[model samples]
Target: MMSVPNLDQLDANALRALAAQLVGELEQRDRVLDETRQVVAKQAHDIQFKETHIRKLTHEIAILRRYRFGKKSEQLGGEQGLLLEDAVDADIAAIEQELINLGGQPSEQKAVSQPKRQALPPELPRIQVRHEPHSTTCTCGCQMQRIGQDITEKLDYTPGVFSVEQHIRGKWACRQCETLTQAPMPAQVIDKGIATSGLLAHVLVAKYTDHLPLYRQEQIFARSGVRVPRSTLAEWVGVCGVRLQPLVDALREAILNEPVVHADETPVQVLQPGSKKTHRAYLWAYAPGVFQDLRAVVYDFTDGRSGAHARAFLGGWRGELICDDYGGYKACFEQGIAEVGCMAHARRKFYELHQSGKSLIAEQALKSIGQLYEIEALSADLCAAQRQQLREQQAKPIAQTLHAWMMAHRIKVPGGTGIARALDYSLKRWAALTRYLGDGRLPIDNNWIENQIRPIALGRKNWLFAGSQRAGRRAAAVMSLIQSAKINSHDPYAYLKDVLARLPTHPNNRIEELLPHKWQPSAA
Candidate 1:
């Protein structure tokens, strides 16, 4: 509010004072500008973070759309399909982690602070609303007579609801006879454990079939007001596996007796005894009859992928063995087993070459392979002898043509390219791949068996690793039964529950009847 003298009219002292004041004002402005820049920088960082997240979500959605609605597997072919699959996998993992975080603090916990209502499950038993009088009397001051009232529903929350089942065995007493008679307690899967058959089945299905790890199940039980621990759930599983061992034995026997079987293996991480680190264990799947035979599959858990493991389980059994190019089956084949190669494996090689934009040699091979499949397609309903004849008439020529084409192109393509690899693969496996043409009983590929073992693959992603070698074998047993049950069109949970209930009482001599193919659900 004070006026300043002009520099030209004032003395040096006044001018010097004004100059110092102006310098102070400039420094204050600089400080304010610095503060503003810091705030802007912080805001810019947050915006960048939000933009990156948005871009990620958008990319994930686009990938999901493409995988769901875009060109299918055959069109996308080999590598391209894998890329899309990986993208979808990343999105799914992100969602799973988000779900895990969400599950940590459930909505029930927040109800104390904010009592927001939600829809109760329709299956829950409900209590009718308690009516209250709106007024003591009508306008005439007379007692109001009873009339129809409107009803409304509101969700009520009960964190956990459970009941204690009182298993009171009937006891008969006669004072005159001075004697007492009581029925013996029924046997359970766990001799001393309090879990029922239904509970055992629920736990088994949750962990193995549904891929819910025991820890997650433990959390679920806590939320449901039960204080079951992961260790206890795991013990139940192990005990159930032991009780079901006889059925697994029967399944293996039935599988080994079959004339044709498909075999495949997948890696599993398992902790070996005396070793702190885990080792890569293999789950060897032997499907007795996938396509035309029985739906039963037996899995052998081995510590290594050696040829000896296949030979050991197979036990010198002579039959047709269909598998991939894994040389581990060489011993089995050498032991008088008819080696059948998967045409699907050969086809996939060519598919990869085509996807790589390599020579048309791969496409030509695929076309020839497709012709063979087309013939098999037409003969789907034919019996074995008829299918054999049909294959000899039509499929034989396709295999022969594909073989000749491979021999011719093997020299043309570069030695290390995809086309060259495909040609070499088909040519090397020419005998085994064409063996399917000899027997209609043989499947075109090991894909069906692969489907059976896919549960183990998906489950491994959730469970991460097995605790021990014995634990891995137990897992194999459950997986074998579950997959066999699935292929036989039986509800796995019901089958397991029934088997667990009856296994203890059922005679070991009649255990074969409890197999997936032969088992009948006992009446409640």
Candidate 2:
């Protein structure tokens, strides 16, 4: 260490310079301290935020556990019970994953032991897969002898058949090396997964297409001589959903490429974060026009029925949109997207009035609308040009006469009456309603998309609600491919299996080839 000089021995100028140096050192020290404090504060804040998140997750898990194990009255019956149990299993899995992500351990629950399983059916075909040692020679140059073998059987399912995969692993050991060797396990869609691609496909098709929940699948698998846990099945589903997202993205782009597209939205319930309750979410479906050769539909899931979601999805793709008069789409129309209204919506208003059996005007309106539908039926088999010609010749006159008759009747009816409101609905949107007459490619109603949404509606009765927003979107993506596969007359299970098997190595730029419309099953 250097020795300090006496202050009295120094000159006045030197003393002043010394004071300046001291002041500079003090400022530098202060700056360093300030920076250190800022870093510590940030770290503390981060730790607090993480702790809060962990507590919230812990609370959610507890609630789910209670619901899963609580009262019998809370439980449902039949198909709904299966769906609810599956949902609980999925939610628990999802929460555990989140906990793991947060650097926390998943709370352990004791597994309930199951009874002895029944033997598998004798009629089902069994495929043997032999896993043997690559080499019988040891490091010491001694030949190894074949010892015993272990055989494990896993039940696998194809669409309509159940098969058993007999995995035979042979044991080989050398006395010199004192080592045993067996062939390494093959890679699968899920690492160390007992499920085969065929089994995975069956689960997916059953869940997404058949709308059978995971718990139901669990029971089914149990019946087949294996008791696969619902949690494991949910994990597999999550993995498949992630793997299949790229294909869904490609499908969305294809749907948007068409000149005329069908757009519609349906409500689905989604569980809100950190709560036991759920909120309404919308699944917006888009498809190419009925006349377009591309037979595919894509679904987008949004947390709300906001027009912004539609605008974001459509993203400057100026095309004719066939949809009902929902104000959510008004913004889209204002942005220069051509709106082709559903004639069915207009007819429904009059149909409702006629059903009331109180309005002659409504009956007249239905007769006129019926004439329009008859024209559409006649043109169904015709080419676009011929269909348009027929529409202009036949349907246009009827629509004009209907418009004139409605105007004449409106003056005779009271302002707030049902018939008056029905008339206003048709007249106010007459241009959009009649726009389909000029283009044969446009559908007469939003029924095509409505039909596409029908399966989702039916599925809601079984599965009840989506577990979360991510789950909703995942459901939408998988359903898009499934429904699109059906639209193209391809088997959904075959399509999904082939795609899932090839997805890991399938070229990203050429992902469109895996789409339902263009996909061809592999020869192998």
Candidate 3:
């Protein structure tokens, strides 16, 4: 082979040009790698699925064989079923581990059984047990002195027992003056209410985070032999929402200050005043600065999915907004807010078309979108300036090429067809779609906000509908704190409990301390 190329021989411009060429080659290689990964993922999914089915059939076969020969079929079925499950889980675990070693994404549906490290809680009360032999005396018939003793600790649990706590103060009287005085009562989340801070925290977490409806919570309380009504719990939640407003306000301010924000909306069912029927409402979610370690998710509840809702939510703050092809957001762009389109949305349109039928145009569009995504995956870990430079060098060309192809194909496709619609959607949003090339901090998609909206969608499926508009507002306020805590990777229950316990006595001016981005456990 000839002598190896040396960087020292290359000048600055030459080195950059060479580097660009190498980056292009690497990008091509990455595209091939990603396609291979997708194929492997699909194959792995199929294999695991087939393996699970085979195991099930084998268990059934064993049971059938037992039934044909003897009377212990029921027992054999149970045993075989459990053994097969364990085998399936172990095999899948090995397969997943192998895929991980090979630097590929594993199929999400695979069942992997990994041992969980179980230990007693460090803070819970523990019990110690001591074991001693009855014959501890020396064999020579002499009494032995105890040298050392062994102790073991274990965790113990007992069913919850309810109790009532009452505060009583003694009255002092000055006989000459005939004056009586007593201590002032301490502040609380609910004044003179039977519920304590801990109980209120549980109710809020259960209702909003855990998706437990008030009626279900009432049933749970009854199972615990408590007689609290569902109405009482609802009142508690509404009160907490109102009290938590100061912190939520601080959260909104912090989020709105960020340079980049992601916004999305989902439909909600609400009962209108003086009307037996329900009206559709919307929950608008705004997430700020997802690139940072600490971020905030703010939810605004509105009566309709109009552009005014987004304008009101993002009042006077001008920055980049990543969203889909929704017409409601057109006004935001019109009002001078820079809009960045979601590549995922564009890809999804083509993905549906590809799945519905085989079309070279659709497949080529998917491939082009995939190339842009590969460039993004490569730049995920770089800083903003570097990432922007990389995008300019690598992603911009692909985007330009894809846009040209789309414009050319849009004219040839028949009107009103799915393929035509996909092409039109992409062509209409071309500027926003290519916005990420200039700003590295902005993602190619609004999946960040979309993810924040998923919980609300799931919640609606269970809670069914909001009692009224007021209830919808309360839900938004409470969900903001819970989801923000989740964004910061803090347990929602613990964060809510800490906030509720302190908000009673915490100063209103310092409510920012209770915001999820700034809040931390007292011990932490």
Q: Name the candidate that leads on TM-score.
A: 2
Query: Total clashes, candidate 3?
Result: 0
Q: Looking at candidate 3, what is the lDDT of residue 313?
A: 83
How much does candidate 1 score in TM-score?
0.68
At residue 251, candidate 1 shows an lDDT of 90
Model 2: how far is 226 from its true place, Å? Answer: 1.0
Record all residue pairs in model 2 with backbone atoms less than 3 Å apart, i.e. clashing. Answer: none
Q: Using TM-score, rank the candidates from best to worst.
A: 2, 1, 3
Candidate 1 C-alpha lDDT tens digits along 1-524: 24666668978888888889888888999999999999999999977875665555445444443443445632233433332232232233333223233332111121122223333345545555233444534444454444334343332222244333334443334344334444455666666565667677777787778877666776787676556645456556766776776788889888888898889999988753223356798999988745556779888899999989988888958988889999998877777998889889989988887887965777878888899889988987888889899999888877777677778778777798777777888788888888878787877888888988888888888776665565677778888888889888998888887888787788889998889988788876
Q: Could you tell me the lDDT of residue 212 within candidate 2?
A: 80
- In candidate 2, which residue ranges exceed 4 Å CA deviation? 1-125, 129-155, 166-187
Per-residue lDDT of candidate 2, residues 1-524 (tens digit): 23457999999998898888888888999999999999999999988987888888788778766766767676655654555555655566566666765788766662353123345556669999999877888888999988888876666777656888888988888977788877766556665566677788888889988888888788887776666777778767866776787889888888888999999999998864334566899999998988888999988999999999999999979999999999999998988999999989999998998888757788888889999999899988898899999999999999999989988988888899888899999889989999999888888888888889889989887777886676788789889999999999998988888887777677899999999999999987
Write down the TM-score of every candidate: 0.68, 0.74, 0.67
Candidate models: Cα lDDT each: 0.70, 0.82, 0.71
Worst 10 residues of 3 by lDDT: 150-159
> How far is 406's C-alpha from truth in model 1 (Å)?
1.6
